[model samples]
Target chain A: MALPLVIDIAIGQLRRRKRQSIVSIMGVALGVGFFIAVASLMQGFQQYFVSQVIDIAPHIVIKDEFRTPAVQPAVAAFAEGAVAVRGVKPRDEIRGIRDARGKLAALEAVPGLAAAPTLRGPVILRYGARDHSVALVGVEPERERRVTNIEKDMIAGRLEDLRATANGVILGIGAADRLGAGVGDIITAVSPRGVAVTMKVVGLFSTGLTALDQGEGYALLKTVQILQQRPNVVNSIRIRLADITQAEPLARVIEARFGYRTESWEETNSNILSLFIIQNAIMYSVTGAILLVAAFGIYNIISTVVHEKTRDIAILKSLGFTEGDIARIFSVQGFVVGAIGAALGCLLGWALIEMLAAIRFDFNNPVLRGQRGFIMSRSALPFIFAGGFALVSASAASILPARRAARLNPVDIVRGAA
Target chain B: MSAPPLLEARGVTRILPGEGFGAPPVRLVEDIDLTVGAGEFVAITGPSGSGKSSLLYLLGLLDRPSAGAVLIDGEDTGALSAPALARLRLARLGFVFQFHFLLPEFTTLENVMIPMRRLGRHPQDEIRERARAILASLGLQDAERKLPEQLSGGMRQRVAVARALANDPEIVLADEPTGNLDTRNAATVFDVFARIVGEHGRSVIVVTHDLDLAARAGRRVHLVDGRIVSDGPHSPVVPQAVA
Candidate 1:
């Protein structure tokens, strides 16, 4: 019945002490504001990194070889027993998908997926008097574009131009610069078996990764097979899925069916993902300390109010106000301050993110030279988390002072009789 | 033949712990019994340390009796829970202290409205209306909106009285309500108490050291050494009621 009055008295007391209340509120606001801003920035950076990796590479890569080598026939024959096969070296084997056409046909049954087969081998490019060793990659242009971002990264000619010229090749921009080669320039591609073939450079691309830019030379699938002395064989197939998050499960299924090694983007980046988890832990603890300090500020102000208003408490008790009512009055004050602080802090955090995101910062590293800016996540979770933390801290800070106010004895307080 | 008393104290006692080790606890009020009927003006008078104020506190339910019970309108108060006792105090008893303990943060009208709000017997508008009426009747209409610090000593004391009568309790227990007032202010406060009993039909139990003021009551209970030395009606009604 008197709940409103109890809350009203609590608010009235805080209003009377305007400066003290404002100070405590600002403390909470600072804590929440920093928490939101920092958490959003960290999440934004993580998302930016993951998206870059996802956009450049296939979600799942299927290779013709297994991660672990197969045991010898003698070891396999001794099934449950340890077989000592001394002085037996593992066989030097040629690696390729055993039945490429059959596997490709079977993969078509998988829905919402794109797969492209590639034959990769080592080659040396010779232009004039200078020669450089590079990985010679053979890809079907139309199918490769669907599985990777190679088409979007082209700087000069088109990938479709490779199909027009039977013996055409594409050099990375860095490789082209090193060889002084241009579009339509004829270059000698020396095979590992010393069989040399002349091919015209039809295109060039740059992906901002120095290792890829300086080490890869692309050519037609038939051209690479003829040069590497391997006929009708693909070493790997790259796959793209409609949902990137489903890559691990889909890769497992594909590996199980094909008896080949498969790798998902998640498996490849597990180390970096675990690092992000640690970053979040550190971020929360640092931000949590700020909120704890703010709670102490609230505790200080409420303690002072309880001490100063001892007479008012006694008078209210004599007027038949219960102990619970007195405690509620002080708790209400803490809650109001926390709520107001969290609201203002959210606005402040949003503004901070916007301001930081507007300033551009250029990364000058040679491997990944690009324009970088403070990325701010637009998700609502950080704001909710900060507000909840503030409320809990504020409530905890109020308990002791409220209890002290409730425990006052009215008889000793009324007439100063004691 | 008459109606039972509105408040009764049967053999109530209170003991305070002594200061030194192994010292016995000092008794503030002994096995004393008293009753206050409706519309009765009674005064408890004695010298300093005679347990007069202690006895008033015990009867008012502000303090619990160590050995006996206090009954309000025939209900044994000892059996009630703490909250129930508080509710009984809110709906049935009022208290006036030596100092005008009006909440300094609130205006005079709000001070009077505190009890009514706690009791929750009326809506916001009605509470405001009754609070204003009480202040107006006490001749503090112009001062109703003023804070306690802004009012004179007598005006503040009157505000305290108005607050005491907020819930229209059956008994008003006053512990030296005029102890801090000057002679003129003391007389004015006594007049208000006299009217509360005479016109409103509410009982008033005051503890005082002023014999002149104590002599004006219909009955007097004098305490000495934690025991009632004399308890009875004063013969030949003194026509010295303040108003």
Candidate 2:
């Protein structure tokens, strides 16, 4: 039979059972809509969290530590024997990156890579008898700007001012408020090694992270080395790559070259990234359950249609419709319903996303500090996936019923009718 | 009998499988031999449960015979696949039942167009025109757009007749087509069958219980308990009815 005629017959039958058809279509629409909406919301928050993590820190950090302890000279000498060695007194060596300048120059030669050396130590800030303990990080202003977003986060003064002002420091706004200090205020920073330096605060900044805002400050690398009693020694090298996705591999390459412990941003935040996986699992399962329920509705309607159209099926067979033709007729019905439902579902999902975007929350948790409303990814992937899922499910749900209809015996029905 | 018969059934038998667990099967038709030539009208008449409809079904290829073979245009149909048989039916056969069996959702015209569309030998416009011509010949031109539910019983049966003739089949097999109609409608349906044979020169095999209608056909086959007892031409009770 011609396909148009088959489609005409199928559509006429669906029109005859309009209410049931509408109900089944609505079920699929709801499934697809919820799938898209939930996917958008979850992926939006995950992407936001990932961007925050990437922007707030270096893509790769090489610290002055070995991934494994150095082999003792006795163990190295007895390579073949299972020798038991007790703990021996370790050599007293200053823990700092050796030849930091040469390593930085080599890293700077690589394309699309930026590197900066920094030294960090615990210090006590004292102003007018008020004491606040903070981690003092030393940075070269020009190199630091290329490796981190600290310069962008400054609210008051430029980081370059640290080079112009002698013994200058930059404090986070939260830390400065605790010291009752502002730009140009002189504060005494007493290092753990009993070296005290009075420095002028050159800038104040805020990164919206509670830990960084309340407990960290930055100063010139020379001044920090002087206060810590370790002049010209830097302990950490921060790196930024043009492509953030290349961090883990580049970290491995750098670690192999320098023999230092390297941490990629993904490795630094692996716990949170694993939680995103669990979140995705929950999202897919919940949406898949909805689609499964919707598929049941399609099955129910098509099965009933097969039962009710038994006589028509017999008549069609007698009129020379092949089993394949009959099957196609009913299968087309399921496909049409799914297609219509998917179309409506995309619209509904877009409306839902818009509604979600308009909703504002007044709570001030640190994790959601700058967000005014829901974050939702407006991308086409969710719609395509949800629509395709519904289409496949709806078509699959119709197969058994179509097969049943095709297998009905015309002779039996005609005889029974007689 | 010079030309080959349009349809032939030789020693055809159909058995209904019994209920589970070794019950005896019932034979719906037994060792029936029949042949229908072009332009001939044959009537099968029998008492209740006499298997007249069963023989008709076997001859129409609507059911598979347990034994023997049914041939159409001298081709043995027993070895053909189901799809091939369906194609044969689409190209050369038509069927009518006691209940008209028109698709209720379709208008009378679309119902008639179904067979022609399935056969797909003609273009769509030609198929529509052919369906219209057939319905108009059956005096159903005014009722072409009406659904089956909106038509009277006789009109519905005539619409079914129009549908059967849509694909221009060589033979039409009808099982008790006028059984549900009144005497006047039955006569009208008989007249339609007469016109199909006389004007179109097509063969029609009808199953009916009405002896008066059976006598009007050129040949009559009487069945008694799944076997034909008599096969011959019948003298019409009303002489004018044969024309």
Candidate 3:
């Protein structure tokens, strides 16, 4: 019941000293507003990068390779773990999965899983007296669409059109530009097995990745296997899960189930993911530092209020106000200030985000050549975080001053007045 | 025997830390015994540094005694927690300091309403009405909305007295409340205290150095070096009985 009275007094005190109160509020608002703005921009870029990785790339890639080299039978037979086999050359290693069809069928039965087998090998593209080195990927168009976004990236012919045309090929826009070819153009591809074949261009795609655009081509799975002289063999099995975050665990499960080397997109891009972590760490620390500085402003204002209100505190104490009441009065003032500041900051931050999103950044930089405006995330998380942080900061800043106010001895002050 | 003393101090003592290392601790009040009965007007008088204000603080429950207990309505307050003692003070006692230490941020009515609000027994409207009535009784109805700085010294002291009586406590303890007032205002303040004891049937304990004002009270307790030098009726007719 006395809380309302305490709040009234607290607000009265704050209103009486309007200049200091407003200054402290502005300081906190600035901290929270900048925190939200920076977090939105940074998180927007991260989400953009993650989307690109998940859209164009497979969630997990199971390859015909081993994470660890096979130990020789002779090395394990004798020598107590210290045996080094000398000059024992191994036999020729098979380069493709022997049971890819079985593996693909098994993967299809797993819940929320999609898999596509690809016979990928290096090749040369020869068109009209021009020769270019490129890697050829063989994919079943329907299954491939479940694993990657090749269907969406198609700007020319349909990806399903490759199903009817046995030797139909898809070239990236960069490759098509270099070859001076479009749909229905004939191109000669020389497989790594030294077999040359002519395939008709069926589709062209632009995925915004320069390396993939310029250096890769896709064709039907049976055609590539026949051309490569490895009939019915696939070197890679791409998998996509319903939840991208589930990729790592599912990849480990698949690796353990089959003796295949499996890697999730997160594992393959661990460096970039770690960089995102560092970026988040730096962003939050900067935000926290600004909030800490703003807390000092609150501290200064509250300390002044305590010094100015000493006589009032003594009077309240003489009137039988508990020490806790005195402390609550000041703390309630902090709460009011902090709440108002955070609300204003959220509005300010939202407006700044809109303004930043509207402003064009036309640097013509290669990485963001066609990107028109700043990437700004619309997530409410950063705003919530900033508001919560400000409240905590203001509350923490009020404690010392409130304690000092409560500790004032009424006798000493009244004696001074006498 | 007479319904217990409204406010009583039995061997009350307050010792603070010494000024220098290894020096003897300073005793603000030592073993001072005093009592104020219902409807009694009592004055405590002493020279400067003689513990008049300190003893008043102990009796008001604003300070804890180092050795003995101060009792309110026969309840020993020694073992009460700080908040419990504050509650006891709010419900049973009120205090007026020499400075009329009203909160400057609040108006005169608001200052008076603080104790009533802390006591939390009445609704806001009732509190406000009671506050206005008290201010009106003290002839401050027109000045209720004025800040403490806007009031005269005497009016401010009267406002302080109104605030002390806000909760209608059993005992009103004042420490040199008229020390800063002129002679005329001081006489008015003494008259207010006499009426509070006589008409309202409440005990009034005042600490002052004005010997003339002390002589008018029903009883006067004189202290020297934290011990009572004399205590008894000031006249043959009790002041409260006459009023």
Residue-level lDDT tens digits of model 2 in A23-97: 999999999999999999999989988888788799999999999999988889998878788888888888899
Which pairs of residues have clashing backbones in candidate 2?
none
Show the lowest summed lDDT stretch of 10 residues, model 3 chain A: A362-371
Candidate ranking under DockQ, highest first, comes to: 2, 3, 1
lDDT of 1 by residue, B1-243 (tens): 766568888898899888799998989999998888899999998777889888888888878888888988877899888778889889988898888888877888888988999899999899999999988888999998899999999899899999999999889988998888888888888898899999999999999867678777889988888898788777332332222
For residues A1-418, could you state the per-residue lDDT of candidate 3 as single tens digits?
Answer: 2448889899999999999999999988999999999999999889887888898999999999988888789876875877867888778766898699999999999999899999998889989988887788999988999999988878899888888776899999889889898899999999777999999999999887888888988999888988899888899999999988899999999999888899999998899899999999999999889988888888888889999888888888878888999999888888878888899889888988999899987565444435677788999999999999999899889889998999899778877777
Give the C-alpha lDDT of model 1.
Answer: 0.86
- Residues A1-418, model 1: lDDT tens digits: 2447887788888989999999999999999999999999999878877876788778888888897788778889988888888898666666799888788777766888888888988899999998988898899898888888888778989999999986999888888888888999999999888889999999998877676778888888888988998889899888888889789998999898887999999887889889999999999999999999999998999999999998888878888988899988888888888888888889888988898889776656543346367767888999999999898888878888998999888887874742
Question: What is the alpha-carbon interface RMSD for each candidate?
Answer: 2.4, 1.5, 1.8
TM per candidate = 0.90, 0.94, 0.92
Please list the residue runs of candidate 2 whose C-alpha ends up more than 4 Å from where it truly belongs after superposition.
A1-3, A124-133, A173-190, B1-3, B235-243
Model 2 - which docking category? medium
User: Candidate 2 chain A, which ten residues in sequence have the lowest lDDT sum?
Assistant: A361-370
Model 2 agreement with the true structure over B99-125: per-residue lDDT tens digits = 899998899999999888888888988
Best by TM-score: 2
Q: Give fnat for candidate 2.
A: 0.64
Alpha carbon deviation, residue B86, candidate 3 (Å):
0.7
